[model samples]
Target: TAHRWIGRAYFFAGVFPAGIAVLGVAPLSSTGFVSQVGNTMLAVLWLATSIAGYRMARQRRFVEHRRWMIRSFALTTSIVLNRAWLILFVILLLPHVDTTYGGDQDAMIRAAAGASAWMSWVVNLLVAEWWLERGDARRRTHRTGQAADRRDAA
Candidate 1:
């Protein structure tokens, strides 16, 4: 349960930045007053969620501190991975895609920048989720084995 909450918090933290960035990139005036308000709410919610998660972890209610720590680390790592992915995508994938799409040099640069940014965000989110899930699974398995050993010893 605590682990799940931590995961949710981390998920929201990642989403908040991405959402803010998206809104920053978008033509906000194209939307209405409500949209702007909603964006602000999202930013607030993101911060709240992150704080709640940290508080929960500090409480140390769950014996699965290892699991939570691994998850927190994995979540924090997305930032680094996101930047790396963006750089690689721009340098490698974007050029190929632009050329295949028959864009001129200037057009290709613009397209690559736009596409790489979006793709990098998506890829980073997916990879972060996968890493967290895998880490959780591994932790669970190790815990189960330890429990079994204790039982056998008794």
Candidate 2:
């Protein structure tokens, strides 16, 4: 399964390094403490979800595996989504940051980064759950249609 393979690749390449950097190097840096902590937790969550998905796949619990994969994928894409949020923040709020952060540019940037960091993954996860529910509903509809057709044939 490509999904399983992709999960493996993403775990090794993306999540692992993020965990290492966040848990280790970020602490040494003198910037963005709140965002660093949030992202560190996010990295840990991503790793946990990725491993859970792999375990479900190994156990042949494919439906559960798919659900976890969707979560993992959402977390993975949050990096990109984070940028999108940051862009929105910049466009919509950067100019008004003087009133918000009292003209402290660094503070404003950090606040934006932290908010985007948290929002990206949280929003994506919500959307993923919505997607999963939609998939479940569609599958249920399809099964119902199939059952009706079989009864008619009999």
Candidate 3:
């Protein structure tokens, strides 16, 4: 299927290059040292989640694979969230720029970008995990209910 093929291509193209870029380019980033570290951590988690998903699929652990893949997808989409967070942080920090950052716009932005970068991926991954857990709980509850019904009928 085209969707699967596209996903495979993304895994190769998007995931690998992102990991490589963070390792090779993050150190050279002007966003400050802490942001660089955060970027590196995000990259590492992205690659790790992707690899874990692929391995789980190969090992026939479909549920684990699904969870990992969802996590990977959430991380991948964090770029979009990062942009949104950047905007939100910037707007919220505007009034504080003069007071909190000593009138340094660059410093304020650096703070905003750093916070957004970390929050984007971390929050996304957390939400994904929470959603997946809720789904699993719901399925377990439904299964238990069905089992009870069958026993009652017998």
- Candidate 3: global Cα-lDDT? 0.88
Writing each residue's lDDT as its tens digit, candidate 1 over 62-132 gives 43444444444544454465456446645765556545656455444444445444443345445756876
lDDT of each: 0.53, 0.81, 0.88
Q: Which ten residues in a row have the lowest lDDT in candidate 1?
A: 29-38
Ranking by TM-score: 3, 2, 1
Q: Residue 69 in candidate 3 has what lDDT?
A: 92
Off by over 4 Å in 1: 1-24, 28-90, 93-103
- Residues 10-43, model 3: lDDT tens digits: 7788897887787788677798876788788888
By lDDT, is 1 or 3 better? Answer: 3
Clashes of each: 0, 0, 0
* Candidate 2 wrongly placed segments (more than 4 Å): 1-7, 25-33, 147-154
Q: Which one is best on lDDT?
A: 3
Question: Candidate 1 or 2, higher TM-score?
Answer: 2
